[model samples]
Target: MADEKPDFEVPVGLFEDFEDLKAQVARLTAQLQTLTEGAGEEADEASADDVTAGAEEADRGDAPEDEWQYPPFILLLDPPQYDDELRALTEWVEGVLVPGYLAEPSSDARWCHLWFEHPVAVARLHALWLAWQELTDPASCGYTGPSVWHRDHLDPSMRELRGSSGPFAGCTKGEHQIDHRIPGLVPSAWRQNDA
Candidate 1:
């Protein structure tokens, strides 16, 4: 009533002795491990029990025939930064591994496609593709978009070049500053220069 907190009796520390505390903890830990091991063993036993049923089902021809589906396009592009590399990797898979997998029809071969999730692996393949492309064409400069090599990202460069500077810069306002292209690369702003 007077705006003061009420007092209550405090409880004593639960474990009075270190050895007892350690023994209790050890017991709890052992109990937990035993429970977990039991659960795991039961699960394993259940799985083992399922084997006969699985074999019977397989015998009945309920198992699917071997057929490979093309990997999902979006999953292939999971690492957008490695798009160039992924393209080459997928090409190699389609060319070399896929044919072998199809010919062999083995479960292990199916996993080769799954192993391609690593971006670095895809990038390595992409590097190979670039090397091949350069060797074959001798002048294929690839998508040299502003994003790939410009000062700011691509959208800004496109916006600036299109005569709309920033959100505030108006057509009649600031004197248009002709933004340079990526360093060391010449940009053809004028139509005739593009040729």
Candidate 2:
């Protein structure tokens, strides 16, 4: 067969139909909300549903139990940018969060005791954990939110930080990775320096 490009199709004129697109999106959103609300049995059962909605509302007040609420993240850091902030954040993550989480009975097997060595890995993993918390907040996060979080954030970060081709690839020694140390405790790396 002669070389040929496959036929492609798109709306004939989208620029002229901005209002139409907005209307369509509004309709779809309403439909999605309707489907998401389902038979209204949950509304009947949930007293708190009358008060607030979605992630923003969840930030306002305590949500009722029996919803998909996730506890506040215990390991949150400041928007760590400067050297001081980074040092503090790294300290908290490695010295506090990692050790504390590992001690917890609920800590996941996949992450347990996996020393995240690289600074980027530390920051990225912390960010992912924070996103997971936000995505699992039942009051604001939709039913599929956690699934989205898993697909979009957890899967990719885990792969990059722990995958065979990624940061922790050669770092593991059996169940343990020897390449990492608690960041705050690494005197060699963090020794006080005069600029």
Best by lDDT: 2
Models 1 onward score TM values of 0.21, 0.35
Per-residue lDDT of 112-171 in model 1, one digit per residue for the tens?
Answer: 233344333343334443443433331222232222323333223323322223221222
Report the number of the highest-TM-score candidate: 2
Q: Which regions of candidate 1 deviate over 4 angstroms?
A: 1-79, 83-89, 95-111, 138-195
For model 2, residues 28-70, the per-residue Cα lDDT tens digits are 7877886677765665675555543655557876555644464
Q: How many backbone clashes does candidate 2 have?
A: 2
Could you tell me which 10 consecutive residues in candidate 2 have the lowest summed lDDT?
103-112
Deviation from native of the Cα of residue 142 in model 2, angstroms? 1.7
Which residue pairs clash in candidate 2? 54-140, 55-140
